[model samples]
Target: MIYNIYFDEANKIDQPGKANSYYGAYGGSEQTMTDITQTIQRMYEELGTKSELHFREYNHDQHLKKYFKVLHYIINQDVNINILIVNNTEAHSIAEQLNLTMMELRNLFYIKIPERLFYGVTRHLHGQLDVNIQIDRNDEYDALGLHSKIKEQMNAHSVYRSKRYKIASVVSEESHESIPLQIIDTFMGIVVFLMEQSYMADSNTTLIKSDLVYRFLSEGGNVERFIKQIKLYSWNGNENLSELSVGNYISQFMVYKARYDVSEIAKLQAIMLKNPGLLAKEYRNLMEYPNTLTRMLLGYKDEVEGRGRNYLLFQ
Candidate 1:
């Protein structure tokens, strides 16, 4: 679906008695979702430059809001669109805000909002003109003016339980890339932070090789940065590829190659298989981290190959 909304309910800040106490019942989509895959590739290239390194500490809230706005802008501008809402228990109010008939909205998208608002907001937002107003839940604001049916649904819940709504779903759907982009963004942030603070190195040696390889595979296995970063790091006569931790460098490269379809990624994978010594002991030791995206990359490559896409990876 063009619109894949994640709506959270009872996320109110001060409402400990209510649902979603800390996060505040927020529902929204990111603009980048439509182009997330491409954006990840672009981010891969942009991370190569020192000037773009600040993305390490980039503000997540601001980026998410910006994407949300972008998505809304697109929906308002495009006609005959499809949308899905991941239903949240408390946000029947949003249904009233979007102006889509409940059935029409559900048919085009997946709804996950709490079921209480399902029918109420469905009726409220339908045929409404003001689609951009911000909504809030508090003593003075009862913005939704929800229908009795919704109220009855909420009352049906246990005293300690909150209400829920299930937005409808359509048989046909358009997949977007927001989730993938967010994943890539998170990794890029870590890479940038490591590089910016020089934590990328163990002692004297820098992470230039790993970072460069990260950028290379991030761009779908392009080897241009691989050559450039190696050359740059080796500028001093004493430094060379052999001096860097083989395991770390290879792991970094595998991460990028796993995400994209590149020509020689399999060749590079083969290199890792034939010469495990290319990565140093200490580098391999870091695999102790809780989640290994590098492993995921390997898995992704396997899946791609299974789909009959020309692929290669060292065992």
Candidate 2:
């Protein structure tokens, strides 16, 4: 089977700052991907889907129903959704500690996001699956020969050593013309807005955006399932990968998950081994709030791994 992946990013990852950055990939079989575009067109006629599908242009009063229809359809399809969230402050600090130029570190992430998105989607399949990627037009990636450079690296991934998947082509297209790009762009905006907690601010725009997000997740357990498909996480330089790799050092990514203090983790582990039943009943009874450094992981079903207790109160 052949796959066509559309890529988009939110936030400036290269620039040094405290804010979080995000990159997203969304696509699937060529037929499925095309069907999504056509499906939205039909919805446009029936439900009056907005002509401008970009999330930044969203108006709660006019676009909520239309956007929700698109969002609902996208989530239900058997497509791959992968997002990379990066902590900009941590990245710059890592660059300083490793004595690498800011440009050098930025170059690494520019490649890793697409590489991981490709891997995250195609890793499970074992066959000669032809993969093509189209990135939304952006300044950061708008350089001659960059597309070929990315294509070469993706085709060289170790996961594809068994001839599992081959990168066919990498191209850039305008988001306005590309339905796939616009779709991922909206999803990217949602993830970034939520992670930044901008919704907590008492602003008219924030309130509208919050309402849209809350409505998307209004159904029971819908949040967990929706979040899972996206695989939204980060590479914050927590662990070093400088010496482990052959070429330049790349920051290892840690997926989004809850985080408790060391003492709390140990205590929870003890409980798991002693009385597994009690662990469930009192797992929410955290002694102190979860560590604020990482803001904890979200949508955890259980504490079997002792990875954490409060998933940043995501529940």
Candidate 3:
């Protein structure tokens, strides 16, 4: 039987401060890599239907072709196996290069592995939004089936939870007043915009824009009015103010005035999520918090630090 597996490349070796070989470069503790891998594996087994099927994992340390070799050994004859590769990055050029490199591997494997036994999966992973779907290459059945399956799986999986407002921490003795309605409205608009841009990009695409939008709202100010002011001076005069389009403009602004402290907190959370080793330490910090902001920020920080840090580092 040709086993179809989804392939995603992650930098498992820790080097938090070193530059990424691909995507935006940065360096951090190897802890981040370990955490993400565990999360994915646990999530897959806990969430995926065919949990027992080996995922055929690989990382930057190994060349793409080396992975194909393992597949060749598994499939010698008329068995059919399909695998999809995933990564985090938005630049199409990067994805294309990875694909080309994979093709080179296939060529090498053709002599070693049966061509009939190995065919690329019809779909791949998106970098930014982390959405998975089959590529729409005019193949109706595969496209439809894959899209439906991915959607179904995501809806069913509770690997992570989402919340509306991000809170840092609250005192048990007192309640922090909710953010102004105007600010929340503006912040939500930015999220809608950022998420839109992210959806249009690759699955590995970092949610940098979303983070920026969140930060913009997080700062104390007349949120909507400030956004409107930013829009007025922006090139298109509010025409590009949707979540995705606005991200483009605001991203530049963030470069000039982004807060590292908040971003650092976000990064810390990302690290905790990926590295279960750090979870205990981080969870303890979180448990001490009396409010949702602390919990949410901690969670958000882990993801940002692990996956989104590079993007937010300078900005």
Candidate 4:
């Protein structure tokens, strides 16, 4: 069977001190692309707007209602969805160990996360299945590099080498021109939003509730099942970094950034001891609120650090 995988990404990959999370989701099936495209086109016509459907633009009540309907329809399809969410702190620690620059780390993740997602999607298949991967084009890197990386990873895998699965091609296209890509984009937006909420809740940041998201979560079992299929991965340093306190990790990361004066790291370290989440948020307004860092430190103090493994198949 020839399966077409449409992929899209959300959130920044290499933000050093940002609280935002990263996600990539890809969905695949033989006929799902065509079916979703026609349904979305019909939705556009019915809504009396020629604009493309983007989840980020779902702000107004009318748009949210329409988007919820669209999501319901798409979630009911037979396509398989796989998602990857990165643990930024652990990823940063790994990048530091490897001496990778921000851009290099970004490129590595661009390849690694998606490759992991693809592997999870096809790991159980024991028959011939030709997979064609289509990613939304982004100028951060060229299509050739991504294509090469994906091919390399796929060929290196034992299952693929056994001839049960074949990578037909890895190509990039404009999201606006690909209906399947748009559907994946919408799905990723929902996933990213939920992740952000979880991050904020961990950080003790104020949570913003979305009725649309709640509706999807409550509508039926499929969306919840789809979410359970998401796989999260992170590169731990030589040791299990999650076992370390947020303060300890920050101090270590600061040592790596020794180019910055000692006073700055000291000041940040002191603040982290008191208010850890503040360290995760970008230095902007002087707002001091607990965030992920706080949770990490508390976890350390309770001797329950690393309670949750970073990479797991969502249950």
Q: What C-alpha lDDT do the candidate models reach, one value each?
A: 0.30, 0.64, 0.29, 0.57
TM-score of candidate 3 on Cα atoms, chains taken together: 0.18
Model 1: CA > 4 A from native: 1-259, 263-268, 276-292, 300-315
| Model 4, runs deviating above 4 Å | 158-163, 198-209, 222-315
> On lDDT, who's better, 1 or 4?
4
Error of 3 at 71 (Å): 40
Best by the TM-score measure = 2
Q: On residues 1-315, what C-alpha lDDT tens digit does candidate 4 reach at each position?
A: 877777676767566565544445555566666777788788778767665567776544334446666777777776666655556776677778889986788887777767766776777666787788888887764833887788678857835457577788888899778877777777767656554443234222211124345444445674455544444433343332122122232233234323322343345455556665643344212223234233223222222223331111111
lDDT per residue as tens, model 2, 1-42: 888999888777564454777778886888898899899888
lDDT (Cα) of model 1:
0.30
Error of 1 at 281 (Å): 9.5
Which scores greater on TM-score, model 2 or model 3? 2
Candidate 1 lDDT by residue in tens digits, 267-304: 44554565564443322233321222333234334443
Error of 3 at 193 (Å): 14
Query: Mind giving the per-residue lDDT tens digits that candidate 3 earns over 242-302?
Result: 2213335455545533453466565555556556565534554643422323323443554
Error of 2 at 191 (Å): 1.3
- As a whole number from 0 to 100, the lDDT of residue 246 in candidate 2 is 10
For each candidate, C-alpha RMSD in Å? 20.7, 12.8, 23.8, 14.6
